[model samples]
Structures are given as C-alpha cells and as structure tokens.
Target: MNLCMIGTGYVGLVSGVCFSDLGNQVVCVDKDKDKINLLNKGRVPIYEPGLDEMLKRNFKFGRISFSTDINKAIESSDIIFICVGTPTSKKNNSADLTHVYRVANDIKKNIKKFKIIVTKSTVPVTTGDKIEKIIAKKVNKKKFEIVSNPEFLREGEAIRDFIYPDRIVIGTQNKKVNRVLKNLYEPLVNKGAKYLNTSRRAAELIKYASNAFLATKITYINEISNLCEKIGVNVEDISIGMGLDKRIGTRFLRAGPAYGGSCFPKDTKAIAIIADQYKSNLSIIKSTIKSNENRRNLFKKRTFQIMKNKIKNKTITFLGVTFKANTDDMRESMCLKMIPVFLKKGAKLRYYDPSGKKKEINKKVKFCKNIQEACLKTDLIIIHTEWNEFKSLDFKNLVKKNNFKIYDMRNIYSSAKMKQKKINYFSVGR
Candidate 1:
C-alpha cells in the first residue's frame, strides 16, 4: 500500500519506517524542513533504538521517503495517517487538537480520490467524527473515511512493540474500511497480534484509558513502597507476591520515582478532564494523578532526610536524568522538578545520562561527559533512571570518597550488597 504519514514526530517517523520495512511505499511529511531534510538523509530526529538502521535500509530500497509537501504526498497516497501531536491544552487538561484539525483541513483540499484517513496520533474520543465533519464540509463524504487507529508504541522499545504488538486496534464501524485495515495489518495479525475492530470513539478512548491504568499501577506500587519503607519491608517482594496472582501481571509495578513520560502524565490529566466534561466522576483517576504528583515531593523529603538536612555545599551526582533510560525523551522527567530545588538549597549537582546532556536542567548544573567524571569526589550518588550501565557499577571505586552515600531510586541495586560493603545505601521501600 502507498501510505502518507503526516507530522514526522516520534509516532509518524517510527510508524512510517516500520510500514515501509513491511514492503509498503511510505512518504513522511512534516512542516519542519530541517527534520524532513534529516530524514531524507536516512537520519532520524529522535533517538529510538534500531530506527536509524531500519530507516536507512528502507530508504536505500526506495521504500521510504520524507517530504515537506503535504498536498503532493496526500494526492499520491491511498491511505493518509495523521500522526501529529495533540498536546494538553493550556487552559484545561483537554487535548489541544489544533494540529490534528489543521491536518484535516489540509487533507480536505488534496483528496483527489477515495482515501482512508487514519489518525495514528493520540486523540480524544469523537475526534474522528469531528475530522469527518470538517472534511465533509469541503469534499464529498464518499471521498474519504476517518479512522481512529491510536498508536501503542512506547518510546524506548517502539521498534519491538510495533513489530510484535499485543494487539492491533482499528476503529471504524464501516465493514469495507475494517476489511481494508485488517489487510493493511495482516502481517502482524499473522504473527498472533490480536486485531480488534470497534467504533472510532472506543478506539480513541482505549489509548487514553490504557495509559491511565498503567499510570495507576505505577502509582499503586509507589504508594506501596512508601508503606513498606515505614514498616521495614521489601517492595520487590511485595511486587513479586502480588504479581503471582493472575489478576496482576507485573509490568509497571516497579517502585520508582513518580511516573513521568510523554504519555502518562498528560493522558492521566486529560482523561480526568474528559470524564468531568461528560458529567461523570472519575475519583480514582483523580486520586492517582494527585498521588503521582505527591510521589515527587515524597522523594524530595527522603533526599533531605538522607542528607540529614546538610544540603549546603554537598556535591551530588545523578546517574541518569531522562525519565527512563533507552530513550532521550525528557518530557515529564521527575529530575526536572527535583534538580533545581536541590540547586536552590546549595547542593552542587552534576548528572551523566547515557542519552547525554539535557537542556531541562539548570545552567548551573554541570553535565559530565561520562559516569566516572560525574561521580568523582561527589558526596552523594542518586541513581535516578535505570539505564543499563548504571545497573552494575563499582560505586565505591567511582566515588573514591569515604562515607559517600548511594540512593537507589529505581531499586536496581541490591540493598543487602550495599550493606555488606558498609556503604550507606538507600533505596525505595527497603
């Protein structure tokens, strides 16, 4: 199939590459001329594993291309996928659909024949109906079909997830359209990926609800970690015990810093706003949001206690700064909130992430080129993101200072081992 993917952000770029690798011709369109130029050179703007190689391979085969000309791409393709960002609105938590609607208006002008317009972007419910209404105002209803096919790609492991997703959801009641979409995804469907056909609205809601539930699980485990700390218990043992139940399989149950990523924080708030607009009370989700926020502050208090309120002039090193490792995204990273506060309290900070330096941190904070440089002579080592390199480290050798403390935020290291070495180690729960 010839496909046009609009807005070459994470979703657009990754999906376009994956589709092309599956033997489909794909053109990824974006307003950013620089990004399109980069993609045309077989280089990606985002840092996703295996994406650059896959993109370069497909581009070499003439299967994938990038363009700033939206109308031309739209005219040439049989299927148009809208993969623009629908960021949370400033005034309210509802999604700001300006980009999505703008793409719809652009599509209306360029549709020379029947096209299946699928929204691969995360959108609110009824957004497909709204897009259909917009396009119908300018073009005939039979000319195009609006679809809500939300993406389930996680940041770090997007490539693997796309190739082997747990499920593939297509939202459109039209039987003919459903058949076409099923054919489009037949490769994955053959690989045992469940294909579900549902109403467009249900498909849109599924993405948001799925994210909110995962956020709830993270918050649930984090709160449990707090209680475990008070009563002297291991949160991992609890997570293991609870996960043995068929009802709860462990995925997001790791007790760590508050859930912060492109999806969770924004989606949780948006879902609450959506529920309220429908005159429904989603008190549990509301509490989950509140609890996630408080989790950050709780970590702040723990830090102060660990330091015995002697933050002034203490040299602290953060192992990783990105929300989670294996990707370079810093959109709601817990360190974004904590780093500045530590600086204000007179703690000199340096951080080294596997993803490199972050712009979100204060200018005063030094960016170390490597972990060894960041840890040299530092008073405290806070294991923030669980990057692979940080998992097994000779911390005593890295710090090279007596009485240095290690705070394992992700619980990646064993507390018993730290104790055996006579290192002052702190971790979540136990």
Candidate 2:
C-alpha cells in the first residue's frame, strides 16, 4: 500500500514510520521545510522511543520518504491520512479544526484519482462529513471516500501501541472503503488485532469518549486518594484491592497531582464544549476538569504544608517536569502550573527530566545537569513524572545532603524505606 500522511507531528510521524516499516511505501508531507530537511537527514524533531532508528531504517530501505510537496504526495498515493493537530481552541475551548480544514482544502485542489481520505486525527463527531462536503465542493463525490480512523497511540509508548493496537476502529458507511482499510491494516489484522467497523460519527465519538472516561477514572481515584489521606488509610492498598476485581481492573487508579497531557486536558475540554453545543450535559466530565484544576492548587498547598508553610528561601528540586514519563511533551504539565506558584512563593527551584527539552522549560527555573546535582543541596525533592531514573535514586545520599523531605507525587518510592532512612516522606493518597 502507498500512503500519504499529512502533517508530520507526533501522530503523523510515528504512524508514517510504522506503516512504512510494515512494507508500505509512505510519503510523509509537512509544510515545514526545516522539519522535512531534518527527517531527510535521518533525524527526527520529536523524542519518541525507537522512532529515530526506525525512521532511519525505513528511509534507508526506500520504503519511506519526507517531503514538503503536498500535491505530489496526494498525487502518488491511493490512501491519504490526515494526521494533523486539532489543538484546543483558546477562544471557546472547542477543538481548533483550522489545520484539519486547511488540509481538506489542500486535498480539494490536488486530489485527482479515486482516493480514500482517512482522518487519523482526533476530531469531533460529524467532522468526517464536513471534510467530505469540503472535498465534494471541488472534486466529484465519486472521486473520494472520507473515513474516520482515529488513532489511540500513547506518547511514551506510541510505537508499541501502533504496532500492537488492541483494536482498530474504521469508521465508514461505504463497504468499499471498509475493505480497503482492512487490506491496508492486514498485517496487524492477521496478528489477531481486532478491526472494528462502525459509523464515522461513532468512531469520532469513540476517541473522545475513551479519553474522557480515562480522565474521569484518574480524577475519581485522585479524589478517593484524598479521602483516604484524610481518614489515614493507605490509598495504595485501596488501589490494589479495587484492581483485583474483574470489573474494575486497575489502570488509572493510581492517584497523583492530576491528569495533565496533550490528550486528556484538551480532549476533556473539547468534549465538554461539544456536549454543550449539542444542548446536552456531560456533568461528570465538567466536574473532572474542575477537579483536575483544583488538584494543582492542592498539590501546591500540600507542598507548603509539608514545609510548615515556610516556603520562602527554601531550595526545592522537581525530579521530572514533563506531564508523564517516556515523552518530552510539556503541554498541560502540572509543573507548568506549579513552577510559577513555587517561584512566586520565593522558593529557589531546580528541575530535571530525562527527555524534556531545555527550550520548553521556563527560564526562571534552573535546569539541572543530572540527578546528583538536582538532589544535592535542596530543601525538598518532588517527583512529578514517574521516570525510571527517579524510581531508584540514591535516597540515602540525597537525604544526607538535603533536608530529607521528599514528596513522591507518583508514589514511585516505598514509604517504609524512606522512613527507614529517617526521611520525612509524603505521597498522594498514601
């Protein structure tokens, strides 16, 4: 299969590389000349595990290529994947579809032969229909089929998620389009990956619904953890007890500051806005958004309380600043919110992350060179993201230098062990 993937962002770049590795000739097109040049040199702009190596291998094998020519890409492929970004609109909190729409217009001008346009971006319900109408305005209806094929790749583990997806949802009413997509994903389909065919609207809604439900689950457990803390019950045991059940299998049950990522924060807000536009109410989702916001402040308050409200002149180090582990994405990260608060409170701050970009970090915060430097001479240590390096730190050495006050936001440490070292420890819900 020959595929044209537009917008070489996280989803586009990862999917194009993976699909090319599966023996499909993929042309990844982006308007950014600098990014295209970088990819052509066997370098990727983003930090995804194993992506740079895989991209190089596929490019070397002549199975994949990068280009700035959208017209040429669309002309050469039978299937075009719109993997553009639909970031949250700042004006109304709805999904900003400007990029998606712009791609549609580009396709309208360049599309010639019969093609199947798949929306690999997370979009609202009926977006496929809108794209179809936009294309039909210029091209004949018989020349194309709009398919909603939303991606469910997690940032840190995107390659694994793409290669071994639990299920692939193909949203199209056209039987021909369904069969074509099945053939395109035949490699995974043969590996026992379930390919579910549903209406386009359902597929679009499935992406948002799944994200919103997961965000709600995280918020639910965070709230439960708070109650457990007040009542002096260990939330870890509660999480384990609940996870052992068949119905409530534990996944997002581990509580923390809150759910903050590119997907959850933006998608939850987009869905709530979508519900309101439809004259419907998603009260639980609305509350989840509010609860997440409140949790950030609570995290700050908890840190102050741990320091006996004497944050001024305190030296603190944040172990990880990214939203979650395994990726360098800082969008909606708790550290983004908490860092300013700490600085305002007159606390000297140091931060370190294995994958976070130095350019994305705030100028006010001191970026540490390594774990030893970050942990040394700090009044307190806070673990934001559960990065693997932070899980097995030399706590004894850290405690010997610092005040021995540690806040494990991700619960990556054993409280019993911290206590054995005579360190004051604080963790979420435990």
Candidate 3:
C-alpha cells in the first residue's frame, strides 16, 4: 500500500518508519526543510529506541522516503494519514486544529483519485465530520472517506507498541474504508495485531477517553501520594494493594512529578475543553488537571522543603529530564518546572539523561557529558525519569561522594536500600 504521512514529528516519523518497515511504500512529508534534509541523510529527529536502525533499513530497501513536496506525495498515495501535531491553543485549552485543517484543505485541493484521509493524530470528536464537510465542499468527486484512527504508541517503547499494540482501534463502519484499512494493516495483523473496529465518532471519543482516564490515574496516585506522606503510609504499598484487584491494574500507578509529555497533559485539557463546549460537565477531568498542576508545584516545594537551608550554595544533580524517559521531548516535562525553582534558590544544576540532554538543556542548565560528571561532588542527587541506568546506579559509591543526598522522585531506589547505604534519601510517599 502506498502511504503518505504528513508532519514528520514524533508520531509521523515513527508511524511512517514502522509502516515502511512492514513493507509499505511510505513517504514522510514535512514543511520543515532542514528536518526533511536530516531525515534524508539517515538521521532521525526523534529519540525513539530502534527507530534509527529501522529508518536505515527501510531507506536501503526503497520502502520509505522523506519529502517536502506534499503535492507529489499526496497525489501518488492511496492513504494519506494526517499525523500533524494538535498542540494546545493559547486562548482556550482546546486543541489547535490549524495544522489539521490546513492539511485537509491541502489534500482537498490536490487529490484527484479516490483516497482515504485518515486522522492518525489524536483529535476531539466531530473533527472527522468537520474534515469530511471541508473536503466534500472543495472536491468534485465523492470517492473519499474520513477515518479516525488515533495512535496509541508511547514514546520510549514506540516501536514495540506499534508492532504489538494492545488493540488497534479504527473508527469507520464504511465498507470501502474498512477494506482499504484492512489491506493496509494486513501485514501487522498477520503478525498478530488485533483491532477494534467501530464508528468514526466513537473511535475519536475512545482516544480522548483512554488518555483522560490514564491522566486521571496518574493524578489519583499523585494526590494519594501527598496524603500518604502526611499519614506515614507507603504509596507504593497502597497502590499495590489497590491494584491487586484485577479490575484495577498496576500501570501508571507510580507516583512521581506531574504527568507530562506529548499526550496526557495536552489531550486531557483538550478533551475537557471539548466536553465544556458541549455543556457536558466533566468535573473529574477538571479536578485531574488541578491535581496535576498541584503535583508539579508540590514537587518543587518538596525539594525546597527538604533542603531549604542547605541548598543555598550546593551543586544538585538531576538524573533525568525527559518526561518518562526514552524520548528527548521536553514539551511539558516537570524538569522544566522544577529546574527554574531550584536554580532560583541558588542551586547549580548538573543533569544527565541518556537521550534528552542534547535536545532540552540550554545555557541556563549545564548539561553533563556523563552521569559521573553529573553526580560528581553534587550535594543532592534526584532521579527524575527512572531511566534504566539511573535505576541501576552504584549507590555505595555515590554515598562516598561529597554531601550525598538522594531524592528519588521516580522511585528508582527503595527506602530500605537507601537507609542501609547510609545515604540521606527522600522520595514520594515512602
């Protein structure tokens, strides 16, 4: 199947590469000339695991290509997936669909053959209807359908998530659309990919509902983590006990800094804004946003509270910066929030992430070449992302360094182990 992925951001780049790896001739389109040039040179802009190798293999086989010429790519493609970003708008918490709308109009103006306009980007309900109306008005032919096929891939584990998803949710009951989609994804399904077929509107709603629910779960545990701190209860134990019931699984249960990244924060607010527009009161989601905001501030305060006096002239090391690790996306990471707070309190920041430093750090924050440089002679060490290297650090040697104090926001170290190592350790809840 011939496919064109508009917008070579994280989603576009990863999906296009994976689809190409699955034997589809995929072209990734981006208006950014430099980014497209970078991709053509076999360099991936995003920091997804195993993506670089996949891009190289696909390019060698002539399965995937990069282009800034949307006209040519769209004209030759059978399926055009709009994977552009719908970042939060400034005026309201609603998703800014300017890019999506622009892409729709562009496709309408260019396409002459019958094609499927698939929305691989996470958009609110009724967006497909709006796109359908816009395309129908501009185009003379009627051999087109709008399919809401939201992606559920996470950042660090995107490749595995795409190849082996929990379930593929394709929204469209139209027989022609379904047949085309089936053929397009037949390669993956043959390799054990399961899909949930439903209506277009329902599929859109499912994407929002799934993300909002997961955001709520993170907020729920974060709020409880605060209460656990006061009552001297271990939030981890509480979560494990609560999650033991098969109904409540143990994912997104880890307490840490506020939920950030490309999806949860933006999608939650956008979904809530849509719910408000329809006059449907989504109080739980509203509260979830409040909780998340409070969580970030509380983390800042917790750090200050732990070392209010001692932090005046200390070198503090942050272990990870990217939200949840694996990707260098610092869009809404807590590190952005906490870094300023600590820096304002006269703490020198030296942080190390296996992937994110080269992308996120600026002149204000000193980026270290290695974890040793980041941890060397630091008064306090804080683990932010729970990267595998941070989780497996030598605690004994770290304690021997100058002024050893470990604050594990990601819960990479156990309370008992820290105590045994004689390191002044702090963490969320227990």
Candidate 4:
C-alpha cells in the first residue's frame, strides 16, 4: 500500500517510517521545507532511538521518501493519513485543529483518486464528520472515506509502540473502508494484534479516554504518594503490592513529580472540555487534571524542604530536563517549573540530558555538556527524569566532587544504597 503521511512531527514521522518499514511506499509530507530537506539529506529532525538507522534502511529499499509537496504526495497515494498536531488551544481546553483543517482543505483541493483519509491524530469526537464535511464541500464527495484511526504511540519509545501496539482502532460507517483498513494493517494483526472496530465518534473518544485514564492512574498514584509521604510509608512498596492484583494491573502507577508531556496534560483537559460540551460532567477527569497540577507544586515544595537551609547560594545540578528519557522533548517538563524556584532562591544551577538542548533551559540555566559536568562541584543533585544513564551513574565518583545531597524524584536509586553512601537521598513518598 502507498501511504501519504501529512506532518512529520512525532506521530507522523514514526508512523511513516514504520509503515515504510512494513514494505509500504510512504511519502512523508511536511510544511517545513527545512525539515524535509533534512530528512532527504538522511537526517532525522527528532531524536528518537534507532530512527535514523531505520530511515536509512527504508530509504535504501526505496519504500520511504520525504517531501514538502503535499499535492504530489496526496495525488500518488491511496491512503492519506492526517497525522498533524491537534495541540491544546491557548485560550481554552479545546484542541486547536488548525493544522488538521488546513491539511483537510488542501487535500480536498488536490486529490482525484478514491482515498482513505485516516485521522491518525488524536482528535475530538465527530471530528471525522467535520473533516468529511470540509472535504465534501471542496472535492468530489465520492473520492474519499474519512476513517478515525487514532494513534496510541508514546514518546521516547514510539517506534516500539508503533510496531507492536495494544490494538488498532478504525472508526467508520463504511464497510469498504473497514475492509481496506483491515488489509492495511493485516500484516500486524496476522502477527497477533487486537482490533477494535467502532463508530467514528467512539474511536475518537477511545483515544482521549485511554490517555485521560492513564493520566488519572498517574494522578491517582501521585495523590497516594502524597499521603504515603505524610503517613511515613513507602509508596513504591504499596504500589507494587496493589499492582500484584489481577484487577489493578501494574502500569502508569509509578509515582513521580507529575505527568507532564505532549499528551497526558493536554488530552485530559481537552476531553474534560469535550465532556462539558456534551453536557456530561467528567468530574474524575477534571480532578485528574487538577491532581497533576497540585502534584507538581507539591514536588516543588518537597524539593525545597529537602534543600532547607542548604540551597541558599549553592550550586545545584539537574540530571534530566526532558519530561521523560530518550526524547529531547521538554514541553511542560517539571524541571522547567522547578528550576525557577531554585533560581529565585539564589542557587547556581547546571543541567544535563542527552536531549536537553531546548531553548527554554538554554535561556534559564547552564546547559552542561555531560552528566559529570552538571554534577561537578554542585552541592545538590536532582534527578528529575529517569534517564537510563542516571540509573547506572558512577555515584561514588559523582559524590567525590560534592556533598551529594540527592533528590531522586523518580526513585531511581535504592534507599539502601543511599544509606550505604551516607547520602541524604529524598524520593517520592518515601
């Protein structure tokens, strides 16, 4: 199958590459000419593990290609996937579908063949209908079927998620579209994959509900972590015991500073607003959003409490600045919020992450070249994100240069080892 993937952001790029790797001819379209040039020049715009190698392999096989020419890509493909961004609106909790709409309008103007226009981006319910209406008004109505096929890939491990997802959801009323989508993903399903076929609206809601529910799980654990801290209990042990039950499977139960990334925070807000628009109050999801915000603030307080009388005029080093490890994405990272508090308290700070070369951190604090540089001569070391390297760092050597008052926010270090080092190690809820 030939697939035209619109937008080369996280979802689009990974999906395009994966589909191409599956032996489908793929032309990934992006509005950014610079990004397309980079891709064509064998450069990946995003820092995903093993992506460049896969791109090279697929590009060598002539199964994958890159382009800024949307019309050309659209005209040549039978399936056009609108994998553009539906980022949260600034003014409200609604999703800003400007990019989706623009792509729809453009597709309507150019395409002549019967195409399956799949909504691969996470969108609100009934957005497929809205997209269908827009395409109908501009093009021949018989030429396309808008299928809501929302992606469920997580950042940092997107390639793995894409290759082996929990399920493939296709939403459409047309039987033909269903059959075509089934065939499109037949390779994966044959290799033991699950499929959920539902109405377009239901499929859309499934995406939002899944993300919101995961956010709620994290928030639930975070809320419990707070109580555990107050009551003098190990939340990690409690969570582990609770997760052993068949009913409460272990996932997203790790207590951390908060869940802040490109998805959870925004999707929870958008869905809560969606429920509101439908006159259905989602109290739990609304609280989940509030819980996440409260957790971040609580974490900030906890950091300060650990640094009581010690943070004043001290050099602090942050281990990871990205929201999660493996990706350089720093949208709404807890460190972004926590760093200012330290700066306000008159602390010299330096941070390091493999992918933490973000503009936000560059403007605010010193960007260290490596972990050792960030830790050098710093009084306190804060591990914000559980980057793989942090777990296996030469801690004995790290503390040799400094007093090593550590705040392991993600609980990456064991309490026994911290005591062995005679270090003051503060973790979440323990």
Candidate 5:
C-alpha cells in the first residue's frame, strides 16, 4: 500500500515508520522545514525508544520518505492519514481542530481520484462528518471516504504499540472503506490483533473515552494514595490487592505527582467540554481533571512541608523532568507546575533528564550533566519520572556524600532499604 501521513509529530512519524516497516511505501509530510531537514539527514527530531533505528532502516530500504509538499504526498498515495495534533484550545478547552480542518481543506483541493481519508488523529466525535461536509463542498462525494481511525500509541512505546496494537478500530459505514482499511491493517490482523469496525462517531469517542478512563484511574489511585498517607496505610499494598482481582487489572495504578502527557490532560478536558456542549454532564471526568490538578499542586506543598517550611535557601534536584520516562515530551509536565512554586519560594533548582530539553526548561533552573552532578551538594532529590536509571541509584553513596533528603515522587525505591541506610526518605503513599 502507498500511504501519505500528514503532520509528522509523534503519532505521524511513528505511524509512518511502522507502516513502512510493514511492507508499505509511506511518505510523511510536515510543514516544518527543520523537521523535514532533520529526517532527510537521517536524524530524528524526537526521542522515542527504537524509533530512530526503525526510521533509518525503512528510509534506507526506500520504503519511507519525508516531504514538505503535502500536495505531492497526496497525489502519490491511495490513502491519506491525518495524524495532526488536536491540542486543547485555550479559548474553551475544546479540541483545537484548526489543523485537522485545514488538512481536510487541503485534501479537498488535492485529492484527484478515489481515496481513503483516514482520521488517525484523535478527534472529537462526529468530526468525520464535519470533514466529509468540508470536502463535499469542493469535490464530488464519490472521490473520498472519511474514516475515523484514531491512534492508540503510547509515547515511549509507540513503535511497539503501532506494530502490535491490542486492537484496531475502523470507523466507517462504507463497506469499501472498511475493507480497504482492514487490508491496510491486515499485517497486524494476521498476528492476532483484533480489528473492530464501528460508526465514525463511536471510533472518535473511543479514543477520548479510553484516555479519559485511564486518566480517571490515575487520579483515583492518587486520591487513594492521599488517603493512605493520612491513615498510615501503604498505597502499594492497596494497589496490589486491588489489581489481583480479575476485574481490576493494574496499569496506571502507580501514584505520582500527576498524570501529564499529550493524551490524558487534553483528552479529559476535551471530553468534558464535549459533554457540556451536548447538555450532558460528565461529573466524574470533571472531578478527575480537578483531582489531577490538585495532585500537581500538592507536590509543592508536600515539598515545603517535608523541609519544615524552610525552602528559601534550600537546594533541590529533580531526577527527571519529562512527564514520564523514555520520552522527551514536557507538554503539561508536572515539573512545569512544580518548578515555579519552588522558585517563588527562593529555592535553587537543578535537574537531570536523559532527553529533556535544556533550553525549553526554565532559565532559573540549572541543568546538570548527570545524576551525580545534579545530586551533589543538593539539599534534596525529587524523583519525578520513573526512569530505570533512577531505580537502581546508589542511595547509600548519594546520602553519605550530601546527606540529602530523598522524595520519591514516583515511588521507585523501597522505604525499608532507605531506612536501613539511615537515609531520610519520603515517597508517595508509602
């Protein structure tokens, strides 16, 4: 299959590379010249595990290519996937569909023959109907079929998720469109991946629903963690006990500062907005959003309380800054919220992340060369992201050198071990 993927962000780039690896010729289009240039130079613009290698291999094999010409990409492909970003609009917290609509207009202008236009970007329910109307204004109705096929790729594990998705949802009423999409994903279907066909609106809602539910789970656990702290109960034990039940399998049960990333924060807000627009109330989702926000703010209060409210001259080091480990995405990161609070209290801040952007971070904060340097002489260490490197740190050596306090925000360390070493340790809900 020959495919054109628009908007080479995380979803577009990973999907293009993986689709090409699956024996399809894929051309990824992006308006950003720098990103296109970087890809042309055999370099990735983002940090995702195993993505660079797969991209290089597919590019080398002539199965994939990068382009800035959207028209050319559309002209050469039988299927076009709109994998653009639908960020939360600042105006009303609804999804900003300017990019998606603009792409639809572009497709209306460039699409010449029968084409399967797939909405691989996470979009609002009934967005496919809007796209169809937009395209129908300029082109014949027979020229295209708008299929809502939202992606479910996680950040750090996108490649694996793309190659081996648990299930694939194709939203279209057209029989031909459904068959075409099924064929496009036939490789995965042969490998035990479930291919579900549903209405376009259901498919769009599936993406939002899945993300909102996961966000609720994270917030639920964080709330439980807070209660555990007050009652002197271990949240980990509660998580394990609950997860043992077949009905409640554990995934995002770990207590952390908050849930922050591309999907949860925006999708949850978007869903809530959508519910309000239809005169429906999603009270649980609204509470989840509020709970997550409160959890993020609580980190600052918890830090100050741990320091006995004397943070004016304290030096703190954050182990990781990215929302979660193995990806360099800082969008909606809890650290973004925590940094200002610490700085406002006159605390000196240092951080070490394997792939976080130094320039994008606050100028007041210092970026260290490594974990040791970041922790050296620091008053406290806050483990923000659960990176594997942070899990096996030499706690005894670190504490012996600086006698610094350890606040395990991700709860990656054992409290008993830190206690045995006489290290001052604090962790979430445990």
Candidate 6:
C-alpha cells in the first residue's frame, strides 16, 4: 500500500510510520516545512516513547518519508489519509473543519488517478459527506472514495495502539473500498484485531462517543474520589471494586485531576454541541463537562488547604505538568490553569516533566531541568502527573525542607508509606 498521510501531526506521523513499518510505502505530508524537515533529519517533533527509533528505522529502510509538498505525496500514493486536526470550534463548540476542508480541496486538485481518501482525524459526523462534496466539485466521484477511518491512537501509546488496535473500523458501504481497506489492515486483523465496517457517519460518531464515554469515566471516578475524601475512603478500592465487573473494565478509572488531554475535553464538548444541534439534550455529558470544570477549582482549593491557606512566599514544585505522562502535550492541563493562580497568590513555582519544559506555562514560573532541581527547598511538592520519574522518589532527601507537604493528586504514592515516613502526605481520596 502506498499511503500519503496529510498533516504530519501526532496522528499522521505515528500512523504513517507504523504503516511503513508494516511494509507499506508512506509519505507524511505537513504544511509546516520545519516539522517535515525535522522528521527528514531523523528528529521527531513530538514526544512519544520509542517513536523516534521506529520512524528512523522505517526511514532508513526507505519505506517512509516526510514531505511539505502535499501534491507530490498525494500523486505518489494510492491511499491518502486526512490525519489533520478537527479541534473544537470556539464559536459553536462543534468541530472546526477548516483544516479538513482545506485538505479536501487540496486533494481535489491532484487526483489524477483513483484514490482512497480516508479521514484518519477525529471529525464530526457528516464531515466525510462535506469532504466528498468538496472534492466532487473538482473531480468526478469515480476519481475518489471518501472513507471515514477515525484514528483511535492515544498520544503516549500511539505506536502500540496502531499496531494492536482492538478494532479496525472502515466506514464505507462500497464493497470494493471495504475489501481493499480490509486487505490493507489484514495484517492486524490476523493479529486478533477485530475488523468493523460501518457507515461513514457511524465511524465518525464512534470516535467522539468513545472519547466522551472515557471522559465520563474519568469524571465519574473523580466525583467518587471527592465523596471518598469526605467519608474517609480510598478511591483506589472503589476503582478496584467497580472494575472487577467484566462489563466495566479497569481503564481510565483512576481518580485524578480533570481530564485534560487533547481529545477528551475537546471531543466531549464537541459531541454535546453535536447532540444539541440535532435537538437532543445530552444532560449527563453536559454535567460531566461542568463537573470537570469545577474539579480544577477544587484541586486549587485542596492545594491551598495543604499549604494551610498561606501561599505567600511559599516554594512549590510540580513533578509533572503535562496532561498525562509520557507526552509533551499540555493542552487543557490542570497545571496550566492552576499555575497562574498559584503565582498570583505569591507562590514561587517550578516544574519538571520527563518530556521536558513546557512553553504553555506562564513565564513567571520556573522550569527545572531535573526533578531534584524542581523539588529542592520547595515547601510543597505536588505530584500533578504520574510520570515514571516521580513514582519512586526520595522526597525527604530531595526536597530538604522541614515540614514540607506532599499532595498526591494522582495517588501515585501509598498514604500509609508516607505516614510511616512521618511526612505530611495528601492524596486524591484517602
């Protein structure tokens, strides 16, 4: 399969690399010449564990290439994947398809041969129809088949997810397209990945619905952690008890800060707006959004309580600042919202993430090169994200501060252990 991934963002880069690794020739096309150049120079722009090695291996083998020229990549490939961004619109909260449409228009211009145009990006329902219409204006329907194949790749675990997806969804009723896509994914299908073929709209909705439900699960657990905090219970035990059920598997059940990755917050809001557009009320999802928003403020209050309401001149350090561990993405991270508040209250702040310093953070705060630098002399240590580097730390020796407090928002540490160490430790639920 000769594949061209339009937009060499997280989705496109990972998918193109993996497809190339699977013996398919791939070209990752991005408008950003800098990112393309970085990839071509054997440097990855994004941080995903083991991605650089895989991309380099595929590139060295002459199986994969990165390009800024979309027209050349499109002309060279049989399958063109639109792996662009469809972020939530600030105006209506629906998915902003400006990038997707622009790519469609670009594809329309360079379809000299028959092509399989797959929407690998997360798009709203009927987006495939709009993309088809856009391309149809320039080329006949016979020249292209617009299929919706929304990516299920998580940011940190993209490589594993692509290779071992639970399901490969192809959204098209065209039997020829279906057979070709099935054959394209036959390697994974043989690896026990279920192949599901549905209508284009269903595939689009499936992506949003899956993200919304996962967001709800995270919100549900966080709310449970709040109740557990009031009643002296461990949210871990609650998570375990609920997860024992075969119906509700134990994923995204950990109590933590508000769900703030690239997908959850944005997709949940977009889907709620989508439901409203069809004259339907998604009360539960709406409540989840509201509750997640409140959770951030609650996290700030908890931090203040840990500091005994005296934040002035206090030195605080964040162990990790990204939304989750192993990814450099900081979009909608709780720390982004909390950092300014802490600075305004006269707290000197520093943060260290394994993925390195974040530009999203306020300039007033410091970026530590290492965990020890971030923790040294800090009055309070907040384990914001459960990065592996922060999991088993000698905080007593590291902080070197008497009576310093530790707030385990992700509950990465055992409260009993912290108690035995004679250190003041706070956790999500218990």
TM-score of each model, paired residue for residue:
0.98, 0.98, 0.97, 0.97, 0.98, 0.99
Which 10-residue window of candidate 1 scores lowest in summed lDDT? 38-47
- Tens digits of per-residue lDDT, candidate 3, 1-430, equal 8999999998899999999998899999999999999999999988899999999999999999999999999999999999999999998899999999999988998878888999999999999999998898977646788999999999999999888887788999788789889887887787788877899999999999999999999899988998999999999998999888789989988788899998999999998999899999899999999989988888887787778666767888888888888888888998888887777878888888888555455567788878888887788888888788887788657545744788899887889987887778899987
lDDT of 6 at 203: 98
lDDT score, candidate 4, position 129: 93
The alpha-carbon lDDT assigned to residue 288 of candidate 3 equals: 97
What tens digits encode model 1's per-residue C-alpha lDDT throughout 73-100? Answer: 9999999999998888999888899999
lDDT of 6 by residue, 119-145 (tens): 998998988999999999989999899
Instruction: Please give, for residues 1-430, the per-residue lDDT of candidate 2 as tens digits.
Output: 9999999989999999999999999999999999999999999898799998999899999999999999999999999999988999979899999999999999999877899999999999989999999999999999999999999999989999999998999999999889989998989988888999999999999999999999999999999999999999889999899999979989888989888888999999999999999999999999999999999999989998999989898988999888899888888899888888888999999998898546766788899888888888788999999989898888768646645689999999888887887788999897
Instruction: Give each prediction's root-mean-square deviation over alpha carbons.
Output: 0.9, 1.1, 1.5, 1.3, 1.0, 0.8
lDDT of 5 at 382: 93
Task: Give the per-residue lDDT digits (tens) of candidate 5, residues 1-430.
Answer: 9999999999999999999999999999999999999999999999999999999999999999999999999989999999999999979899999999999999998978888899999999989999999999998999999999989999999998998999999999999889888998999999888999999999999999999999999999999999999999999999999988888887888777889998899999999999999999999999999999988778888998888898898998999999999999999888898888889999999999989545667899999888878888788899999899998998656645646798999889899988997888999997
The lDDT of each candidate is: 0.92, 0.92, 0.88, 0.89, 0.92, 0.92
The clash count of every prediction, one per candidate, is: 0, 0, 0, 0, 0, 0
lDDT for model 3: 0.88
Question: Model 3, clash count?
Answer: 0
Candidate 1, lDDT over the whole model: 0.92
Candidate 4 lDDT (Cα, 0 to 1): 0.89
